[model samples]
Target: MRVLKFGGTSVANAERFLRVADILESNARQGQVATVLSAPAKITNHLVAMIEKTIGGQDALPNISDAERIFAELLQGLAEAQPGFPLVQLKAFVEQEFAQIKHVLHGISLLGQCPDSINAALICRGEKLSIAIMAGLLEARGHHVTVIDPVEKLLAVGHYLESTVDIAESTRRIAASKIPSDPYDPDGGFTAGNEKGELVVLGRNGSDYSAAVLAACLRADCCEIWTDVDGVYTCDPRQVPDARLLKSMSYQEAMELSYFGAKVLHPRTISPIAQFQIPCLIKNTGNPQAPGTLIGASTDEDGLPVKGISNLNNMAMFSVSGPGMKGMVGMAARVFAAMSRNGISVVLITQSSSEYSISFCVPQGDCLRARRALEEEFYLELKEELLEPLSIQERLAVISVVGDGMRTLRGISAKFFAALARANINIVAIAQGSSERSISVVVDNDDATTGVRVVHQMLFNTDQVIELFLIGVGGVGGALLEQVKRQQEWLKKKHIDLRVCGIANSKALLTNVHGLNLENWQAELNEAKEPFNLGASDPSGERVSPAEPGDCRLYLEPGGCRSVRGLPARRLPCGHTEQKGQHLVDGLLSPAASGGEQIASQVPVRYQRGGGAAGYRKPAEPAERGRRTATFLRHSLRFAVLYFR
Candidate 1:
């Protein structure tokens, strides 16, 4: 059995829906196949709008007859696309479904309360209409004709539309149910067993869940998910210049990738199917024949193929802990429970027993809440005695390469770091899971996208990833940042990862460890004032920022030291110098800042009389006499002088 799920985009409109029918025909010919589908893209939103409007006392109510007419019109369009399906016949069936929905909506509008059941009932109509239309087209094409509402036979939703599966019984009943009716004419009816039924309204994106559930229910050899993209990309191609498609990934990798940001599959939808060891094929709806990504238990034969690239940016990663929490199992539970209650999602989590810390990342939007929760709960612990105050940093991003092949490759980590090093980006946080299938890094949010692409380059890039880091952010630092931001578009176009991780001043610092906004970093720096002492750690050394001779002295290093750099010792014009007992007149210049120049000086060279290697003679009468003075280098090190009258 083959179960196919067509997302909204795959069956977005009549044209796309017709294409969906054709793909199903091809599958049906091979063997028995069933399909799960989502609402046509705009219909659900439109339905929601109508519901909202009616609730708001707007005069847009489509009474029974009017709704029936609209549904008929929608169906007529579906039938027109497929040859020989009488447009009139399809329209009648659509009228009936819409009539049922209208009666429900009218009841809802009258009551001014759209209950969860009413909402699901209305929303599910789009899929119902599409399937009815598609099924008719399939029958006209001479395939086995049957249509089933997940709500009627396969699904039994609860009070609020939550889905739960009692599969053993649900399957037994589907196996025993009567010949399913041609869904095109629902009045024709079909028999469904009593115990084999439970409401399984797939959640939003639940179509994928529905498809997998059906595949597992049928004990099918495989399931296919058809969607818009070719397959999962290692990174979002739009954001990363070098994002690559991951042709195949293990069940675990697929889950991990989706959890990060790979959108091809749902995060939890894969586990149930994987439990059955069912292989899932991800095929593009646009190119139906192309073998897309596949998920299975078996490892890849080509050495772990790049599974996919994924990243989460603008994140704040924190590791909060104290010795009190060390080796304490419930500490994580307490912290995570608190986060969960506040509706905060921690995307990645890891812990160190020795360090007694648990670090995870939350979306920037929730960083404040997460920070507040931890600080409030662990405040006294951190300030009064322990180290559990929480070490939180925002403006961060996480990029990870997930593949099971990591287990076999001894130096995979090496290559991962090398690629970013070539690009000159830094790794702020690094974690390796116990499974070792993937390694993730927390970097400046600005470089998040670059970090993913650079790793992609190392793993699959034709050209290696080179990175640069820019430190100084003042006059020259300002100019340098502007230049980087302006040239960044061109640089990315050229595949140069010019990363500006952290920009510092004397008080606060702003970083894009992922890479700065090449377009507006100057203003960003002007508003920032973080003091920093530079560190010389090179992760990817390609260069986020190139050092200007002047930039090196100012921007290259983090903070300016009070003592000036490269200053020459000076004596007073009055021949005054520090005596041993007197305070020394030390002459040193402060380190170079945004702008500067050397002081004025015009010391003359003079020679002293020399004879048979004897010491140079002093000025004629007195060194301070009112006469001309001549000086010469005696030992070629210092000048000796004589006064001439």
Candidate 2:
């Protein structure tokens, strides 16, 4: 049997709902097919808002009405499209569900409080509605439909909002239950219950967990998760434009990536499938023809050493250390016990080898609570001066590099740190699992996106990328662009991605992240909207703002006297050095002093044969001089290229 789970985006509208029905019908034609589904897009958010508004002493009727309207419109559209859609029955079911929702909201409003059990029941109403609509559509197509209530068969035990599935008991119940042999089952049954059978849920994004639990209980051959994207990517495709889709990965790699912030799968979704040795596929519902990523026992070892890069943002770090902590037994246990008691989940942890200190990270929203827990837990140690005061850092982010292949490879960590160093991003704290499957580092929140991009490029991208911002478009700059355009094919042959990201003359600035069209760059720059304001604010005409990190600036102005005066030294990715008559400072090229003219003869020739700096060679003939200057301009362009890489 093949078990499938579709996310909210897969069933957001009537067209998508019909598409899901088609997939289920096709799969059911072969053998038994069971599926789990989440609420239509934005429905659960509306449900949550309803509860929040009622408890906050505000009218929740608008949210309730908005949610009801969504369902009503969906059912109406389906009725118009499908002749025998059983619209009346499904509409009555929706109305009855909303009536119960209104009753709960009224109770919460009257008491000014909403309990976890009631909130879970209310939030899961969307899933119930989804199942009912899908079942009706499938049954209309002449297929037997069986709806399994998760609360009745899928037993769970824990907190009402986020509970753990009782696998043994749940599997036993499924075995004994009379699940229709020939029916296509749609289980919207993630309303798991505790030992006392109280209403509970598997947490947010728990639909994946629900599907995995059901797959494990039924012992399906494969479990497929259908979502919006084609598959899991090397990084968040939105964050990294060139993020590649992973064809397959190991179960451990998927778990690591999910925990570190890969949203394609929930962290808990992998546990049940992995425990049962079941293969799982992540596919896109919109593009079913695409071969999606597969999660199995082993991954391809011949590919990139790192499978993926993932990150978690808006984090806070805590440090607990003192002389008393050294060689102290049970100190680590106590530290974690405090966090557990307070219900603050720690995302990453690292302790000093000397046993003098322990450091860990938690969500920024839980910083205050974590601080209080630590303080209360170590009150005696603090009073006795045995432990130091807790050190807290906010506005931090965690970036993790995960792969099962990293264990056997050497220098993976070095390469990761080097990439961050090149981007000028600092590492706050780091941890690597003993399995060598992942390495995580904490960095400033502002730098997290750039850090992930650079690391991904260094580890995954086979081609070298050189982003250039040319400041002058005179004879030298124009010749450089022509040379680049002519050599474009050659660069590609050599696996070099040379992009002219920005071109600026004295008047305007044109920029494109996807690389400008070298053929029409002159016209594009002339019509560009951003003004070239270098040194426009500084009356002295001395300093210009530094270029962004990882960009190489090339200035070939023959007459103008724009200089790099006020640029900070730290902003320079490559170290500052003086050679010949030029100053290669702050990744910029300019004259030696302010108001000094930069002529062809003064321009340095650093990139030459034999890798040694060459001084200007003045030719006697005028034609020879022109050719020589052209050669110098081309060579100078090479300097920018070398610095960028």
Candidate 3:
């Protein structure tokens, strides 16, 4: 048997609902199929809002009406598309569900409180309604459908709002329930029952957990999760533009990625399947033909040492430390026990080798609760001055680089740290498991995006990128751009990506990170409204703005024009010259002024004066005007080239 679970977006509307039906039907043709589904898009959100509003002593009728409209529209669309869709029966079912929900809301409003059990019942109505609609559609199409209610067959334990499944007991119950061995059985509902038979939910995104439970219990060949994206990516494609789609990954890697803020899968969803040794495939429901990512026992080892980079933002780190902590055997246990007692989840943890300090991260929303818990746990020590007060660092983020291959590979950590260093991002804290499957670092929340991008580029991309910003549009600059344009193919052959991000003349500046088209660069520059100011200073000093630097400038006059003296500064460095005739000085302009001296020594520049060509020369004090031009070219070759490997 094959188990298929579709998320909210996959079964959002009538069209998507029909698409899911098609997928199920196709899968059924191959063998027996069992399916689980989430509520339509936004239904659960509205349900939650309804509960909140009712408990808050406000009118929840509007949210109820909005949710009813979504179901009403979906049913209407289905009726129009399918001739015998049983629209009246489905409509009555939806109305009865809402009527019962309204009654519960009234009770909560009367009492001015909503219990978790009541809330679970109200919120899980969406999944039931979805199952009714899907079953009606499939039955209308002359297919046998058996809707397996999770509350009846699947067993769970814990709080009503969020519960953990008793997989072994659930399996026994499922086996005893005698589920149909037919060609197709579309299971519905994610709400399970506790030992007391009270309705309970498996937390948010629990539908995935439910599917995995069913898959493991039934011993299905494979489980498939259908969502919006084609598959899991090396990083979130929205944040990292070049995030590559992963073809396959191991179960451990999937769990690591999911736990570290990858929205593709719920962290708990992987446990049951991984335990059962069942392969799970992540596919895009909208595009079923796409080859989505596969999560199985072993992945292709030939891939990169790091499979993916993931991060969690809006985090806060707390440090519990003092000399008292040193040689404290149960101190770490006490720290975490307090957190668990307060129901606060820690995202990452690290400790000093001396055992004097222990640091961990939690969601920023729970920062206050975490601090209170820690303070209470160490109250005696703090009162006696044996331990320092908790140190809290808010507005932080955790970035993780994960791969099973990292265990055998060398330099993975080196590359990761080097990437962040090159980007000038600071690491607040770091933690890594002994398995070497993942490396995680905490950084400032503001730098998380840049941190992810640079790390991804360093680990995944193999090409070298140079972002060029031309300061002058004279004969030399124009010639250089032309040469770049002509040698584009050669650069590609050599694994180089030279992007002309900005082009500036004496009049204006035009810049595009996507790289301005060289063919129309001149015209684009002419149309730019940002006037160039040679005398203005750019405080950022990275881009050529209208501001001129206080230090130095270079002017290239025409063949007959007199040489214009450069702006004076405290020191001339090595580019100072007193030439009377016009000369050509062509060199790459480095945006980073601080890096000019270092880059100047690395890149070579060719200089020509008096219609005579001079080879490359080291930067030094020159005796002749031509040699001075060469020295200046060498000094200015500080234009940046960032190599990624």
Candidate 4:
């Protein structure tokens, strides 16, 4: 069996979902198949935010109701957009899921009780809702789908969305699960469909697990993951004009790529699928005819150990150091135990075997928690450890390159060093594991765009280029876009190519990686005629597109507005528009603004309204003579003037 997994983006909406169905149908023609699903695009992040809000003291009960509304609308919108789909029936099923979660959240909020376990349950709902809808849609398409939930086979914690697979037990359980052929029957086949329906997500890249878990149980030949981007590029194509894709990669290589922030595949996915030696395909929805990047166990390459470049942004660096009990054996355990107790998960970590000091990473959001945990538990070690209890940094970015070829190759780092040097970028921190499939580094986020582009430039050769589907077109976002558009010609002329992939308003979305024509953006926007969704409340609430130091190119123009909904159209940072005085006059001159009122009703001016007239100035001597003549004429005309008056 070939297992195909479509990510949140691949099945985000009705159209993409339909596209996914088509992909499945095509794949089925080759062999027996199954597909794993992720939550709709961006849904997880929003759900995460809601959890954060609850932690910050917002009543999640009402928010759950609000989320349900959003879900229902998006689902209906997608259904209506896709043709030849039985979405009417599908809509009710999805709505029911929305109601279930909303009901639970409402109950929790009313109780004013927010606990880690409760929050994880709430967070996992998005994926549950997504998978349920997907399985239903697949069934509607006449495909046999056995939907599974982690709660059934995978042992998990109530406080965390992730569950560690009891490899042998879960595998045996999955293999034994059965599916009911009848569409209406609730009983289902060789999956968790019949067990606990509540979802228990795997860590960070849990959806990958849903696929791997199923794949491992079935011993499938391959697992195919569908996403928005084409197979892995040499780098982020936007920065480097020529980031190309390697046709195939070994499992070790894929794992390294993923670990270093490539995001091509999930790390845990490797342990399950790799152990079974099942190959995986990274495919893109836009181009089915194209052969995607194949990741398998076989590793045989004579050249080019490095395959692709990846990056992670918005990272925080946290370090704890002290000289307390240098000979202590439990020092490390105590520090970590405290963080775990506080429910703060540490990410990247490094330590000296000497046990004199320790440093690690946590998501920026959890920094405060990590700090508090350390201060509370290691109060004595605080003085012994060092002068400072905590050190932190925000605005850092991480970049990595993965390749099995690197193991046998020397001078790999030379190329990277030279590329970064040529670009005048600095590397903040470096970490590499013994596997040698990947090289990782930390850098300032400010250098992220430039840094990634430079690596891409040094790596790949491609005619097809990067595309960005920008959502918020506010100040900085708007400025950067305009700058990109304006400089697009220059970039293309210099052999660099990029396009605006898509633009979404609050309610509408328009995209074509070939790029929507810049000159007629407004006309195109009006023609697309999609519903627009923009409001006072966006996640950033900054709702304003960022305009910062690098955004000078966008703002040279005196007036411009982001294309986001509710924003008034304005000029780009670099462009020139009519001055305010003239612009104001033009507005007042407008028939609509003027209410068809005549200009004579408005104000006085030297010139008459539409009156044919000429203006002239006499010379100085002639003007004096004319004044004397006017005075004499007035005196002589006194009698006639009096009579006229």
Candidate 5:
């Protein structure tokens, strides 16, 4: 027996739904197949909106109407597609489902209370509608389909929204149930299931979880996830055009990727099936013939050192540090316990070897709560100054590189860092499981996509794409583009693809990451409609950004530190140096009277005598007088001078 799961996108509209019917029938023809179905695309979101509107005492008429219209339209379209498909029965089912939904919404509006249990019941309607439609479609096609409701057949134990499964109980129930055996009967897949007692829902992407649960219990040959995409690509294809599809990956690799932002598979979908050593395949419903990725027990076959790169954005990293906490036992326990008690889940964590500080990442939504929880838990330490107040950095992204080969491969970690460095992507923090299944790094949101592309190049030896955003398209920017276009071939030979992804002047913006035509970039910019703004986002929505921290600020400040804070003050002239330190100032301050006047007007400059070969310091006037200063270098100052007089 095989358990197959189709996501919302796979059953998105009437055509897609009908297509799914065909795939199900075809697969069932090969052997016995049990199916799991998700609600139609965006239906869950609509349900949540309705619930919110009801609880807020706002008009839920639009939501209720839209929900009804959505299903009505699908039914109408399905009827048109299949003339004799029992539209009457389907219509009755849809009307009854919406009637129940409207009743629930009205009750919530009157009570002004939308609890998790009620919300779960409301959201489950989407799946119910979808499964009903699918079953009707299959039956109309003259195929015997057995529809199974997980709420009745599958057993789960937990809260209303995010319930945990009772594996033993679920297995027993599934074992006793009569799954479709006849080649004609493709077990009409059902939405969700719960234990006999109360109705409990499996949280996010519950359908995928449902499929895995059934697959594990039945000990199926493989659990297949059918979605819109062909399979899990090396990177997000929408971002990286050349992103290759992954043919096969280990269960651990798939889990790591899914948790770290590989969207093809649900994070919880793997553990259940993996427990029984059942392989999971991520296939594309749009193209069933495609060899979708096969995720299995062994990681030995895949040759690549890194199987895939995954990233999570809009995350904040929280660091709680205290010198007093060093060598303290149970400190981590207290810290994590507070988070747990507050219902804040940490995605990644790292700590100083000395135990002086602990840092972890949580979703941006939980940032404030996580901070408050830590502060309240360690109130005594904070009040006594033993521990520093929580340091929260927002707009950070976590990029993870996953592979089973990393365990046996040497320098995999080093190669990853080196690749990011080459791309000028700064890493804020890092964490790696002892298992070496993956290496995760935190970066500025702006650099997340570039960071992924950079690491992708290093591991896969693919063409490195440099996404450039050029502001000035006149002299410098225009000239750079010309050179880039000219050297495209030369760069390709070096395994680098330099593409002018964006170009803008003061008036308009014209850009494309798929490599804008440099030869006509100027013409394109002229015909561009939108005004160029500092906050211009990538048209492709691929450029990861909070924007790499330092962007062009004070556009007139030539060659100085690019940070807005590093803008030159009116008091100083020529060029602004980085505050951290200064280097040898060459040909800036000279003994020449004209040079002296310039130097006199500038900030105190550091200099090193040419012959002395000594370090830079305050200039010596007696020997330096009447003689031209050969070379001058500034250090730890914000200003520097380079002049020849």
Candidate 6:
């Protein structure tokens, strides 16, 4: 028997509903099959909103009518398309669900209270109503469809929404129930219908979990998760337009991506089918012909270091550190226990090698609870200065890059960081488990989108073009251009196109949006007639905006604003021009500030003489000249004039 699970979007309307019937019929022709269905697209969310409105002492009838109209309209269209189908049965089923829902909403509106049970029952109507409508349609198509309400057999135990299935009991009950694998059976296949027993709905994506459990218990050959998309991509297609579809991946990689925020599959859906090694296929309902992606034990070689990039937003990082934490045995355990008691879920963790600090991430919504928990747990340590007070950093996200092949590939971490660095995204913290299936990095929330895209491009797209803007092409800039020229062939071999988009010097500016010819950029800059101007005023003395950075490029432009320190401070260390002026000076002088003389030695000998404003001048005392020379090198390394103003 094969288990097929259709997500909400799969059977969202009359046309798609008919399409699902066709897919089901085709599957049934192969052998006995059981199908699991989610509510029509967006119905569950609407139901939740309706509940909230009622609880807020507002009229929720509009929401109720909106939901009813959606299903009712689909039913009407289905009837029109299939004149002989059991439309009356479907209509009655929807009416019954709404009647009960209306009664519940009335109570909540009057009492201004939405109990967990009422909420679960209301939310679950989407799935229940969907199954009833679908079962009737299938029956009309001459297929025996038995509706099985999960409460009758799919035993679960936990809180209302976040419930865990009693696997052993559910398995035994399913087997004894003898749910007809063949929809053609005279008795029809067993299904979790609208029987309202202590209604405990599985959380969001619960239908996927339900299908997986059924597939496992029935020992089906395969489980298919039908959704809107073809399958999981390298990144969210909606967010990253260039994301590529992954043909196949391992269960571990899928779970890591899902938990870190892939949204294609629920994180918990894999555990059941994984235990039995049942292959799970994620297919598109809109376009069933697409092969989609397969999740199994052994993955086919794609020759990519990482399979996909995913991120969880609205995250906060907390740190618990102190001198006393060093060599402490049970501090971490106690800290975690305290968080657990407060019902705070820690999503990621990283500890210092010295054992002096333990840092972790939790959802922003749980920030207060997590902070209080840590503070209470480490109160004594904080009092004695053995540990610092818990520090909470919000407005963060965790980006995870997942793939099994990453273990065999060296320098994946370095490349990952380099990709983010090139994009000017900051890494707040990082955590990687020994399993090596994934590397998770915490970054500012605002940078999450760019971080995912750049990381995906770098890791997967071999022929990727990387745009670089060199503001100073004299010494360090000239050397960088030469280095890039030398590495052009090498980078090409690795499928990287290190294209120089624009090159500038103290005298002139040269630009080729397509890409400056690396072999002749020096000649190009020398022959360029346009004078290099930083924040140049036009004929009217109004600011002329610099060209927009290429769709994907590394940009370094001069800062329009200057700091009182007189440092050419508009430099962006990460190579992006957005925050181009904040810490450019700090980045250039970082080495000197770190008490390193390497910066001095790296300066070319020609610029070793004293220097001021226009050119280098020999100064008294060799040491003073060298110092002035270093200052000149710093200035020469950074050319300030052109900025994205």
| Residue 533 C-alpha lDDT in model 5 | 40
Model 3 stretches with alpha carbons more than 4 Å out: 466-490, 498-645
Flag regions of model 1 displaced more than 4 Å. Answer: 45-77, 89-115, 152-164, 178-200, 240-247, 299-301, 314-319, 327-329, 340-344, 363-396, 421-426, 464-645
Indicate which candidate wins on lDDT.
Answer: 2
Residue-wise lDDT of candidate 1 within 1-645, one digit each (tens)? Answer: 677888878877667777888787677667777777776666666676767777787765554334444455556666676677757776776667766766776787789978765675666677777676666677777666666545445543333344554456556656777545332212101111123343324445667776776777778788888899877666676655456666677888888888777777877578768989999988889988777878888857345545666787788888887787765567778788879777788877777758577889999999889888877766667687666457888898888878887777788888887766644467887877888887888788756654665566567654312222334444444544455555555645654434555455544446542455767666776776544322222222222232322212211111011122232222223221212102110111122122222111111221212121112122222132211111111101111111110
TM-score of each: 0.62, 0.80, 0.79, 0.63, 0.77, 0.73
How much does candidate 6 score in TM-score? 0.73
Candidate 3 vs candidate 4: which has greater TM-score? 3
Pairs with steric clashes in candidate 2: 543-566
456-549 per-residue lDDT for model 3 (tens digits): 8778876554445556665445655676676666766765666666676667767665567999888889889876433332222333232122
Give the number of colliding residue pairs in candidate 2: 1
True-structure lDDT of candidate 1: 0.58
Cα RMSD for candidate 4?
A: 18.6
Give per-residue CA lDDT, model 6, range 43-122, as digits (tens). Answer: 88889999898887777778788899999889998898875778887788789889998888888888888888778777
Q: What lDDT tens digits, residue by residue, belong to model 4 across residues 320-348? A: 66566377678779878998898886656
lDDT of 5 by residue, 5-54 (tens): 88888877888888888887888877887878888888888888988988
Which one wins by lDDT: 4 or 6? 6
* Candidate number achieving the greatest TM-score relative to the actual structure: 2
* Worst lDDT 10-window in candidate 4: 636-645
Query: lDDT values of the candidates?
Result: 0.58, 0.77, 0.76, 0.57, 0.68, 0.70
Candidate 2, 25: how far from true, in Å? 2.3
Q: Model 5 — TM-score against the truth?
A: 0.77
